[model samples]
Target: MINLALLIFLVVLFTQIVSWVGKTVLQEVAFAVYSRVFLSGTASKQRQLRKQVLAEKAELGWTSSQDEFAKWAKLRRKLDKGIADLEKINTTLTSSKTSFSVKFNSLLWILMTGSQLFLVWWYRKQPIFWLPQGWVPKPVAWILSFPSAPLGSVSSGAWGAVCKRVLQSVEEIVKAILEPTVVPNGPFPTAPFPAQSQSQPSAKIEPITLEHEKLD
Candidate 1:
């Protein structure tokens, strides 16, 4: 009976360790995969669009100015329009990116929770060695059992809850960390910004001309 008790304790301890390891690995892997597949891809697409816009802008130039000031005004308007269009595109991209990240984060927590639950159920039938032996005196057994019962239950539940909550908290933190400091949506809470503002707009715009300008 003493030996049996020791064995059970070891099993319980081992399972706890396994649970911890599983949670850690899952969290890390999930975050990495999400960043790589979804986050990185979104960023890359946005970058490509920006580069294409720049190239288009570079193509538009004034070879011969029939109406220098009027042409300049037209060009300025066109540039502003292009920039506004790019801004809209960027907004859409950013919104989609954020939405994907949030969904991915939520999914990760779900997976972690599911995995932990499965592990718990798998080990449920296995006896914990730390538990007091029934053969022992009532007082001794009760005393020994007290620690494992409460501690074990609390630790298990806490771990599970913490895993879920931590994942959610982490997502919120990431948004706070990555989100733009300046609110583009104005002071009042009207609507959420389309994407995180990574870089501020430049003070001066470099003028360039394109041979054939096309509006999208």
Candidate 2:
């Protein structure tokens, strides 16, 4: 009979490894597909535009860049809407809450991990994969040495990814809400009024008329 505790440990370790590998592979694949289809020649241009917009905003100050910012903000909202539309289409196609790509990747990860755990179970009843001591590659040896530790770190990485996505979403939402507020008020026509000085008013001069009647 296989030791239950050992089986559990191997299962968890393999799951972590599979999750890491799957995420890495899936990201590369997804980026390739997304860039080829949607971004194509525009990825570099978009990056340049973002840098230019940020530079203009920083140099001119926020109040002055209202029109430029509004243009950028409108583009941003359109991009977000496109992403939401893609997600909606994916959800409908997969009949799942998230995208079909995500679900498929997840399912593949589970199968890969389960197969590995089954191999470990078939070969040994021990809770851990013990490494033979001599002349192994340093990197492989290092990984094998701390399987349990890496599993904990894998969970940490997952949590960090989730937190980063949440923060990005919140940032986008805040930007959307505040974008209109930054618009410069339209310039108004004004009559040019002469500036008043602070000096005392000049005294009025009165002509003397008393001498002329007596002389006549």
Candidate 3:
């Protein structure tokens, strides 16, 4: 029997991979990855050629302004060549992109996610961890024990859920650490001149003289 630690590790690792890479991207690349691995002979050669064309096109970057007609003409020719080669390869690989995509993606989901679900179900009745009795309230204990697990024990389903959540949090922290901080735009220049202020009439000040001085 595998130790609880090993089960936790597997669940965490798979969850992190699926969560980080994203399911959509994995599905998109499934057919591309599969053909190279499982096909042979001419199919393998076509895959290799397609890969080479893609790498070369990526290196060429996007088409820019045609400042020099000669250079622009050459670039355009190379771009067209790459596109033609890709189309040829795609046509050779499968009759329909939509049909092939659905087939490979479904296979990937069945193999990856299906296995995870099976593992959790197979171990549903078993407890991953045996906690001390009376440590938690009856309701809390029941939740931890859930399904068929004995009270005061942590069920496989609950523990796997916790482990996956913790791993996802760590993945987020790692991404945040690797992300570069954006420097704010430089200080913008203010108005060239101050605005003119409205002026009000100035009141004349009268100085008061002492009574003795006035009398004198």
Q: Pick the candidate with the highest TM-score.
A: 3
- lDDT by residue (48-138, candidate 3, tens digit) is 7677777766645654445566765676677788678767767766764567777766766665677567766777788878888789889
Rank the models by TM-score, top first: 3, 1, 2
Model 2 segments beyond 4 Å from truth?
1-25, 36-38, 62-216
* lDDT: the better of candidates 1 and 3: 3
Better of 1 and 2 by lDDT: 1
RMSD each, Å: 31.0, 25.3, 10.7
Instruction: Report the CA-based lDDT of candidate 3 relative to the real structure.
Output: 0.72
List model 1 lDDT by residue over 67-139, tens digit each.
Answer: 5767666666776776776787678766765676677657655554454555445444333434333455666
lDDT of 3 at 22: 81
Candidate 2, after superposition: displacement of residue 64 in Å? Answer: 8.3
Best-fitting candidate, measured by lDDT? Answer: 3
Lowest lDDT sum, 10 consecutive residues, model 1, at 150-159
Off by over 4 Å in 1: 1-45, 52-67, 117-216
Reference-based TM-score, model 2? 0.23
| Number of the candidate with higher TM-score, 1 or 3 | 3
